[model samples]
Each structure stands twice: as structure tokens, then as C-alpha cells.
Target: MFELIGIPPQALFGQLLLGLINGSFYALLSLGLAVIFGMLNVINFAHGALYMLGAFVAWFLLQYLGLGYWWALVLSPVAVGAVGIVIEKTMLQRLYKLDHLYGLLFTFGLALILEGIFKHFYGVSGQSYTTPDLFKGGTNLGFMFLPYYRGWVVVLSIAVCAATWYAIEKTRLGSYLRAATENPRLVQSFGINVPVMITLTYGFGVALAGLAGVMAAPIYSVNPLMGSNLIIVVFAVVVIGGMGSIFGAVVSGYLLGLLEGLTKVFMPEAANIVVFVIMVVVLLLRPAGLFGRER
Candidate 1:
């Protein structure tokens, strides 16, 4: 019953939770995009379509093979990553040396194709995935009742984000990726297959998108159009975070999510515009993004 700026703590915290959950999706999806753009120089507009594909992949497994969430966790990313590999080889590889805009356009077209196909079959009515048995309960936290699944989402998302950050920021392979992006010729001279490196990097990024799709399967209604709608907001997050900085994407994604949550409690009308407002402010303050250097 405690009042927080004229709103109850329950309302505030609930909004906060919603914001964090949405932010998790933003972080995961944007991180993948940031990686591809920064390192591979590919503007992957098809990412959201690929994310939708991941969710569908999970649904397919459940329906036809009787696979559970646990199995989908391991399998969906692999499946999607394989598809990414095909895309890179068939289409994206040809555009590496051309204008970056071409990459964006090609991928955009690909997104439309994918969305069109799914829309044709599924018709966008939305499908649901039930939470697993282990994650279906709620916990009384003394102040409020917290659903186990929501908590699991928050905790697992943080862990995945952290692990991804560590892998790219702290490891040797990450060093090569950074180096290769800055100077592919130099990295190739060092005997690393730079082309393969680019392909794998793109795949890994797509795999991250797949992981997000699987994670989101149970929480949000599965629908063909889900990724398309969320992708725009995520793009705004990328712009705010700086497309070149992975950590920036992750941190800003979560921060904005929390900010959106706070807005929902005190000024519901402001929730949708708050992120863009912040993005505009950030751009005015630092045109290169919060963590990026001006080019």
C-alpha cells in the first residue's frame, strides 16, 4: 500500500518487471544486430524474421517431434544457426564488398519474403506455448507475489547477456573477431580464414536471436508478426546504444526497459514514447551513441 510518487509500490514493481522482460528481448536481439553490423558490416534487417523462425521452429518441434522446452533450448538455436549459414553463403556473402546499403536492402527483402510466407500459412492469429511444469508456480516474496517464470526470465536473460558479453569481450576468439573486423587483410595474413570468420560470426549472432526466440516462446503469444513489431523498437534501442558497441546495446537495452517500466507506473501514456525520447536525447548529447566513437 506504500505510495511511490502517487502510485502504489505494487504497480511500480509490476511495471518494472514488465520493462525488464521486454528489455531482455531488446538486449538479446540488439546484441546480435550490433555484432553483425560492427564486425561483418552487414545490416541484417532479416533478423526479426529469423527470430520468428526460431519460435516457429520450437513450435514445430513440440507439435511433430514431441520435443519439450529443454530440448528446444538446445535444438532451435542450432537449427536457426544452420539456416543463417545458408543465408550467408547464398546471399550475404556476395554483398560484402559493395555498399553497406545493399546489405540492408537485401536483408530487408529477405525479411519480407520470410514474413510473407509465414503470413500466408499462419495468418497471424497468434499461437501460444505453455510454460513448462517446473516454471509454472509463483513465489511469495513477502512484499509481492512473484511468478516463478517471470523471475526465471529475468535471471536467465541476465545470465545469457553476461555470458555473451564475456565471450566477446574477454576471450581470444573475440580478439580475433575484433581484429578481423578492423583489418580483415591483417587477420588473414595471420593465417586466420577471415571469410570463414565472418560467416561464423554472422551465424553466432543469428544463433543468439534463435536463443531469444526460444526464451520468448512461452512468455509472449507466438505469432508470425511478433518479431516484425518488436524489431522496430529494438532498432531504436540499437540507435540509442550505439551500433558499434555490444556492451552498450546490452546495458542500454536493460536500462531503457526499466525506464519504460517506471513510466508505465507514473505516466502510462509516456511509456511508448519514453524510449524514443531518450534516444533523441542521447543522439543530441552524443551523436555516436552513448558508447560509440564518432566516425
Candidate 2:
């Protein structure tokens, strides 16, 4: 019924909603990076590959095992997370005593290898995933139409992010996790099995990436490079929010998403680089990030 700055309500709200959906993915992916970096002190450059792996896992389950989208939703993360656990135990554990750059380099190389292998077999083309019948339609919300699957993605992403934040910020296990990262010797003295905790933390972190991949599979084509396409932007979001800041990651993800959407409406050309531009400003203004504490 009304227009804002000459843009119709449908166009404005539609972009905002699209932005929110993108933010949901950003929040999930960045949350995982924040957790891994904050807890394990590993840069985890392979996170994008892990995300791609998750989507591929889902597709594999469907193509090979006759599993459905629901099955992929539940199993893909677990399968990819297990892969993370193995990577941590077999490879990443050795880099713990080294510099952060080493971890980054190691993971970056691993990402290349994984992507190469998949590309050799699957090629660079994107694979299609059908949306579940449960969420195949859209709801007309007077001004704009909202896709059911998208709404589900936003709701589920928010719920998962909230649950993760609560578990890490408000629970006993989270305290132990924080403690182990801070003082491994003391935590180990208490018989907490610090190594195991670290391993599991890494697994859980990548699992978040995996879950995001599964969620994205239907929306975006399940391509090997999908994660690579988004990882940089997600990293920018984490930096803007504050590296290792859980609350910051979640907040920045959605906020940046909205901003990007708005930019698209007003300045389409700058939409792609808007997130990085904000990141540069944030870095210059506050090196520690919006939610990051000064170390």
C-alpha cells in the first residue's frame, strides 16, 4: 500500500527477507568458525570444503542410498562432522603447538585437495536437490510472498544458533570447554580429558558448517565450490562481529545480510562487495571487532 523512498513495499521487504535468509546461512557458517577459532585456536581454512562435503554427503545419501531430504538433514552433518573429528585427531592435533599460520596453511592445503578430488569426479557443475514436499509452497503475507522452506531455514538456523549459544555460554559443559582452552593443564588435572574435549569441539564446530551446507543444498546448487563462494564473506562477517565472539558472529551475520540486501536495492553493483567494505571499516575503527574483547 505504501512506498519507501520510491521503492514499493514488496521490493523492499522482499529484499530484506532475502537478506535475512542469506544472514541465516552466514550466522551458521561463521558460528562454526568462531567456535573452532575461539576454542581450538585453529584458523580452519578448510571449513569451506567441509561445508561442501556436507552437501555432497547429503546428495550421496540420496543418490546412492535412496535417502530423502529429511534423512540428509539429519545424517549429512553427522557424517561430515565425523570426518572433522578424524581430521582433528589425525592431522590437526600436531599443529596445536605450532603457530596459527601453520594451522591455516595446513587446512588451506587440505581444502584444495578435497575440492580437487571432488571436482575430478563430479566436475564443476552444480548438482540439483529438490525441496521437501513438506515445504514446497509459499505463504502470501499481503505485501510479499514468503517461501516455506526459506522461512523454515531462518527459524531453524535461529533455533540452532540459540541452542548453541546457550550450550556454550550458559551450561556447565561450556564452562569446561572454555576452561580447557584457557588452561589445559588445570582442566586435565581435574580429569576432564582436555584432548577429547578439544577434538569434540572441533567436530562440533565443523558440524555447524555441515548443517549449513545441508540447509543450503536445496536453495543453492550443490556445487563443490559453493562453500568457497561464501566462505570469504562469512569470514568477513566473523571479523566484523569479532573473531571468536559467538554473540558477535550471530549478530553481525544477520546485520550484514540486511545491509547487503539494502545495498542491492539502492546500489546493485556494490552489493557484492558491501560486506567486505564494512569489514574494512570495522577493522579500521575497532580492530577487535564489535563483540570481540581486546586481548
Model 1: worst 10 consecutive residues (lDDT sum)? 1-10
Show where candidate 1 strays beyond 4 Å.
1-5
Put down candidate 1 lDDT per residue, 176-222, tens digits, no spaces.
99999999999999999989989998998898888888888898877
Q: Candidate 1, after superposition: displacement of residue 103 in Å?
A: 0.9
- The alpha-carbon deviation from the true structure for residue 271 of candidate 2, after best TM-score superposition, in angstroms, is 1.2
Per-candidate TM-scores read 0.96, 0.97
Instruction: For candidate 1, give the lDDT of residue 186.
Output: 94
Best by lDDT: 2
- Clash-forming residue pairs, model 2: none
